[model samples]
Target: MSGRQLYFKCECLQKGGAFKFRGACNAVFSLNDEDASKGVVTHSSGNHAAALALAAKLRGIPSYIVIPKNAPTCKIENVKRYGGQIVWSEASVQSREEVANKVWQETGAIFIHPYNDGRILSGQGTISLEILEQVPHIDTLVVPISGGGLISGIALAAKSINPAIRIFAAEPKGANDAALSKAAGRIIRLPETDTIADGLRAFLGDFTWPVVRDLVEDIITVEDSEIIKATKLCFEILKVVVEPSGAIGLAAVLSDTFQKNPSWKECNHIGIVISGGNVDLAVLWDSLKKGK
Candidate 1:
């Protein structure tokens, strides 16, 4: 546990069981009446697919979701339940994007990039507004980083409100492109990723990279084992069923890098974003049974 006072912004409790709902909702609703009628399309591993589907349903429009064939069964069900037309693709980004593009072209659905749109970024930023309002004097925020929408929006809004507030990205060591990008002063994509935090495997995008580069203070990378431990802790201690990606912020805060750094001492009150709670129950039960 961290010595500093900790605050959790539980976006996992949101409509679609993830902070992804905020961005998806904003994007879907921002469309003009004509565009909305034509439907919306996007590619996602899980959460965003479900979020966009639910948002489109609320707006009385169709949602075409391009999902990797390997996505969790529970998440695929979420999309179906929310009335999305599912299109399957290979797990790779190129395959996902290619399928999404083909769907958009065929259906004339407005293409919604998972984390690279202005509307989505603005919507994700709302989390920071609520966090600052609730924790007026909080000094630092630890956010999970995937394609960078959540942290980019949070850093932009939080820094604008209190220019000195620190923003750190909690990234999976297996998918540490954000960390590499920060070090290299540009986006960096890995050849392949291997992490249990399935939702955090994405690299930064053009729309999000600028905000991350300018406003984020640091990146704290944690191993998959650490993420798993933090996920279990969320269920046992926090009484929250957080997915591995959602628990990465807590993992980062409790990691040696954050704990031993003297510079981090100034962050007396740290806020952690619990970004989602869409774990596969079968995997969870199996892990618990195996004492993982």
Candidate 2:
């Protein structure tokens, strides 16, 4: 939105329609044949569930997904299409974990956490690995954070290659636990949240919190309206259909956060990660009407 130059690292175009595929693939493949034979299990609202299901299918292994009842219909279809056995639960974090734990216990399946696993971090890290190669002189990266996998991986990889790049996180204000945690200098969890960024509603995981706290320079939270506005812009201007969670990075730029920061002036070349492209067309049309 500013006069400064910005480049987009479009992970929305990645497989399974999100960068979660990278982590899911890595986590699934890291398992041995005997382990994979027992199958794999996970709890997710959408993207990660679909990714892990697809990953398991590719490895010729079984997948059992514990999906929240509120998860998107398209995403549920994706998991089922990938041959994952679906188990439903309430939308709470407690409900998701309990259902997954039961499935894991019954099947003795390997549990691949959406963001808490190290192998998943390694897989997601590959995104920045490519960004640096393509844009060697990039001075800053703007990424969306939910459970923090994408930002954690990108921050770690990008800094390792060129310690010069500054990493920033874009989060929704309605579910701004990450931003709150950053400001508090410790981890924080919300018992509840309300936001259109469904993929980003989860509280930050323990493993991801440390990496995000240490490596991330700052986090900027935008209102739900701001998120919708950015989502509209992505579709109308960029000709790319981005979900609410995916558009938060561009929303951060349009918000006062980027402009108010003195550090932003130092960043001549910035990279923005388009985290996913799984917006429901029904919701997209509704958001478009609101944006107008």
Kindly report which residue stretches of model 2 are placed more than 4 angstroms away from their true locations once superposed.
none
Model 1 residue pairs with clashes: none
Candidate 2 lDDT over 123-166, as tens digits, reads 99999989889988889899999999889989889999998789
Q: Write the per-residue lDDT of candidate 1 for residues 1-292, one digit (tens) a residue.
A: 6888999999889998999999999999888999999999999999999999999999999999999999989899999999999999999999999999999889899999889888899889999999999999999999999999999888888988999999999999899999999999999999999988899998899999999899999999998878888888999999988888999999999999999999998999999999999989898677656644
Instruction: List the lowest-lDDT window of 10 residues for candidate 1.
Output: 283-292
| TM-score: model 2 vs. ground truth | 0.97
Our tally of clashes for model 2 stands at: 0
Each prediction's TM-score versus the true structure = 0.98, 0.97
CA lDDT, every model vs. true structure: 0.93, 0.89
lDDT score at residue 13, model 1, on the 0-100 scale:
96
lDDT of model 2, residue 216: 97
